[model samples]
Target: MARNKFDVDENLEVQFNFGHLKRMMGYVKPYKKEMIITLVLMIIANAAGLLSPYLMKEAIDSKIPQSDKMGLVVLSLIILATLVISGVCMKFRIRTMARVGQCVLENIRRDLFVHLQKLPFTYYDSRPHGKILVRVVNYVNSLSDLLSNGLINLITDFISLFIALGFMLAINVKLTLISMIGIPVLFAVILALKNVQRKAFQALSNKQSNMNAYIHESITGIKVTQSFAREDKNLDIFREVSGEYRSSWMKAVAIQFLIWPSVENISTLTIALVYIAGVYSLDKTITVGVLVAFIGYIGRFWMPIINIGNFYNAIITAMSYLERIFETLDEVPEVADMPGAVEMPEIKGDVEFKDVHFKYDDDKEILKGINQRIKAGSTIALVGPTGAGKTTVINLLSRFYDVSSGEVYIDGIDVREVTLSSLRKQMGVMLQDTFLFSGTVLDNIRYGKLDATDEEVIAAAKAVRAHEFIMELPQGYNTEVNERGTRLSVGQRQLISFARALLADPKILILDEATSSIDTKTEITLQKGLETLLKGRTSFIIAHRLSTIKNADKILYIKDGIITEEGSHEELMAKGGDYNHLYNSQFIMLKAV
Candidate 1:
């Protein structure tokens, strides 16, 4: 992993950001026609609902008193028809909005995933897998309902409120004024509670992400936990994380539900004032029919206010999720293709390091002022004590990380000047840690070259002498090699990895302690395969076993970020340098074992 600019902050702060909402609107823009249609449908639905009160008033004030049977029948039919029309319009509006919401969600998740792939390897090193998963799956999911229904529903409610108000005022202005006396109080209470709700919901989102990270880490390390009998300890830790999440969730819920009862109380108080005022005008200027319609409109009015409160709650929660999602999307790749980078030419495998210097951190340098040049088709063995910058050298050659200063070149061309894909395509690397994807045995080997045929895969396996053991398995090459190839032994896994690398037929090959896991007999077979694979190809081998690289073209004995000795095994032994000391130490240990 290369150095990354990502910082691990324990106390991640998330606030309600209007800019996040504005960015989300870009996704929604594609579905503008659907949104407009839904809005029109909502208006038609609310308008139909508003007409009912007037129809009821007409029946009461005129038809009933005059015994007009035909008028009463027609009014009853009109009320029934409006009810049907409102229900149908609302149903379609909800369906259309939901379709639009799902499309936006799909696009956001796809974009986030594609962006993650483009980010440099170091970005993944700094963040937990679970945290990334949460942003893609959980956080994106949180915004679904808000985008689907909440915004449009809020609009629908406000439209209902205005329509009801117009009807109320037309009936009696004084009564309408009295009925709305508590609205300001409702608004003030909602504004006050909103801040508390935002903090609680944001806290809830953070705790949820934390819990997910811990669970994923624990599950991935379950084998180590159980082998050491630490299951109980892990359970205790999980309990603490889950408890925090639950507490945060409940706190947010408590704040959110407060809007309901607070609005209900204000609603009741306003209706009481209107009812009391209506009593004085029962048989006067305001008729019984008008008073009845006013009461119905008052019910209609408060219902929307209650809905608006719920919508406000949903939006606040969604804003918390959206903030986290966009923050991830905003991360710039630390390593990216330079503008106008030339495509790598056909590689000759001539690699060079010119006064190279690097460090993951600013305070300490891992490799200092290093210079070396290796010819094409030469095998160079790198032997070093741990942390002596051996693997770092391989990483630099691969352009996994750019030099903090100085230059690395391949075939006399600066690596930084080449496109990454063209440079990496001709190199094959098999590291100490062997990873095999979940698939059949043949499939895993074929991964080196996706278009390789079965015959080619089998030939590669046979070259590394993995064919015999693979055939002994229940289903041979067709056998399922589960996740991480857990069904196979470490040695078996390493052999399969070697075969995968050989199948690629790369011009430049790197074996970083690749033979460390194999048994003596298998190691002998692998050495023969390595000789065949290394012919006419530049190779760098990092190994603890001195015998494996003793016949190399050159051996570099590195210590403390510098090459302490460089020569063949016989030459180094005659000189009595660091290489001699290491070879003797390993020989004594092997004899004793």
Candidate 2:
């Protein structure tokens, strides 16, 4: 089972302030023209809303009281015209907003997804796919809603409040001011709630991020938990994480409920005070229509206040996500080719490591002053105890990570000074763990070189002795290998991958513990395949079996990141050094077995 790789405190910040939502609105800069058009339509729509109170007033006070048929007809027609305007303008505004929302989402997703590919492997090393995916997609969706619907409603509420307030005052100034008495109180409440809601929303968002990370990690290690009979223990852990998320959600909801009711009660109390005060203080003639509109405006005014308050958290939270997205996109990938870096001419397979020194981190030295040279078309084996930096050397040679010191040269060209893409193209690598996507066998082979023909694939397969078994399968080359090629045996998977590496026709090759998973019989057959695979390529082979690489032109024994010995198999055995001790012990273990 995988160990717990992250703590809750580690991800809390991502939940709270995504950082500078206003800065992220820069993504909508491209859609400015569309936003302007939508804004015009929305303004026209809101303008028509001001006519609502007037139309009702006319219908009741003028049209109905006058009983003039022509006046009523004209008034009805005008009301109908305003309604038509609102409806049509609103439709145009909504359609344009939707289109812009979708486009903005697409741009964000595309930028994030592409940036993910450019991130260093160290990123994926620390984060699970599920955790990062949930954060990326969920945070992005939150931002979209805030930018689209949240923005639209905020605009609508402001427009409605102003227009309604203006029309109300024109009809009955005293009652309009009286009804709006609690507005400043509402504003004060929102200002207070802004800080509380920001904290609450931050907690809620963080809880979700933790839940996603927990669920993803749990599922990935589910097999290990079940195999070890620790399912109950795992379930308990999951329950704790899930319960924490639930508790946070409830707290946030409680706070939200608290906010609206407090505002509503204050608004109601103001209305009551106005009504009581209106009768006693003045003999103002206020109609039912104007009073009703003021009452409506009272509620409407609180909406924008409350909305801006509630969305303060959302805005802050979205800004945090925006900062992370931009931060990642702005970072330069490691191991990019240097400016003026030249592509080396076709390699003759000669590879050199002149005092290669490396480390994954600064504090620890994984390799130290390692030196080696391989002639064109020769196999070299690296033997070492665990942590002896064997794979580190191979990874450095492949340019996955540049050496911390010293240099690697391919055919006399310094590897670091060559275009990274061009340098890596000369090497083929297959690790102990094989990676196969869901596809036909033919498709997998063709992955080595996208434009390789079917004839070349079959020829490559036959060279590796994979063609015989492939033909025996029901669909031969057409057979579907499910995710990670689980349909095939470990040995068969190795063979397919070997064939893939050979098809690349690279001048340099790395086979890191490639045969460790295969059975002995399959290993022997694979040994034959390896001979053909290494015929013209300069090869570096690392294996625990030791026997497979005995034919290596040179064998190097590594200890604590330094090469302690180097020679042919017999020469090393004859030397009776650390190499001899290892060989003798292995021989004794073999006889005992």
Candidate 3:
């Protein structure tokens, strides 16, 4: 029930969870072969690089002292070959993993988008859209390097660390032990900073989501802001939100910046200690070549430790993003098809509400045990004051929401018993707010029935009296429209939406304030088309204009979750009830106008 706003941070699990890593491996499962090849290449590259220091020791101690020119030349050629082999392996490994990373990104994005489509309206109503967008786009993008390279690097670095240690031990055990003296210190430092670092990153993510939400809300409502001359106020809010994001970034980065320096300082101290120990060793057999080779191994050993530190950083950051991504994917749709639900048969349009009760929330009942029935091919009108549950009735009938108690039936079958797609496909609903995608005039109308032909699209537009205005456009039906049909006036957009609903050829049509935006002249013209369109279809019309519903077969006056009056225009007028009073009030207003 918590509705997220621009400033609020979504609740998140602060503790790190290994389950996320296990789930991530599922994405890598399909590319196991590629990863194995990459790993093998990494091992080969590390092995080739490892041999260089030992080869240097031999050339300096054995070949130079013995004055063996051929031995040195032969060794030099071997070193070049190792370098070439390592380079080639790394080249192929990078290419292979890059391809695998892109594929994983595509799959995750596809799954997230598909799931978002299935989520009910309430899910979206509760959260800022920008918060959702950041997880899908920004957070998912952040995981690319972690998934593609971090896993391989972590394994390779560990292998390199152990191998380097083994070589150092064989060369000089005392110096090797001395070189590892700083490891425990480095580990202690990381452990001390781990919790704080993670918390910092989590805070950063929350701030980023908050700022993004504010930006999106501002952009979407820019017109309203400008109309009300609230630009300065909006800018002030944005500045505050953006400032928090900057502060959080600094705090997180300050924590991240601590890791690399600790590793470097420890590596420096370790090498210096190894130098002192090697020089003062009791074992007089320790030669310059051995000491030099051991020092080379020391660098090799600590480099992997630094790499591992970086890998840990990547994991922590990736985990923050992973939590949000999975959280969205795990959300269960509030309204979904029931188990064993059947595809609805061709609708006969006989709808009945049997003691229906509904509420969006527990405390406020929106509809209270309302009962109504309409025969097939009948036109019914719902008239009521604002917030009187008129829209809720139609929403329940369409199964946009389920009834809290009682049942809504279509042709004697319960709505919840039928598959949502099959049920909605037969019902054409034109909401108060008409939305049009960026496309041609013909395309927007055809959205109702995707496979509809141009001829059929034109026929529907003409039927709704939209064909004339459409033809007057530069390219007529082919002229492109911007998003939300911004190029068209409010009346024009409604007309196109009307045409779209008609083109669907739905057996049951529900129009909620569908004609409120149109001019009186256009309404008169559209009414003639409506008379013909309403011939054999069951229609539910919700209108504030009494003139529009005066001829409807049945008119139900809804008020405060109950039907206060029910009858035709003359019947309600004769009763001098709520409907008659409402009609008279509007009639007087129209006369004054």
- TM-score per prediction, in order, is 0.92, 0.88, 0.96
lDDT of 3: 0.90
Give candidate 3 misplaced runs (Cα > 4 Å).
Answer: 13-16, 281-283
Q: Pick the candidate with the highest lDDT.
A: 3
Candidate 2 global TM-score: 0.88
CA RMSD of all predictions: 2.9, 3.3, 1.9
Candidate 3: worst 10 consecutive residues by lDDT? 8-17
Residue-pair clashes per prediction, in order, are 0, 8, 0
Error of 2 at 462 (Å): 2.3
lDDT of 3 by residue, 464-508 (tens): 889999999999999999988889998899889988988999999
Question: Cα lDDT for residue 285, model 3?
Answer: 69
Query: Per-residue alpha-carbon lDDT of model 2 for 1-593, expressed as tens digits?
Result: 12234335234323324344555677778988977777777777777756766776666666677787888788778778888998998888678777888788888889888878766666677555665776568867867767666666667767777776777677767767777777787677667766676566666665666678877777767768789999888778778778887987887777667666776687678778766655554435755554555555555555665666556545655654554455555656776778889987898987889988887765688988988888998889999898898888888888888889999988888888988778778789989989988999999999999899999999999999899899988899999998789799888888999999999998899999998898878877777878899997789999777878889999989999999999999999999998888877888898898
Worst 10 residues of 2 by lDDT: 1-10
Report model 1's TM-score to 2 decimal places.
Answer: 0.92
| Quality of model 1 by C-alpha lDDT | 0.87
In model 2, the Cα lDDT at residue 577 comes to 93
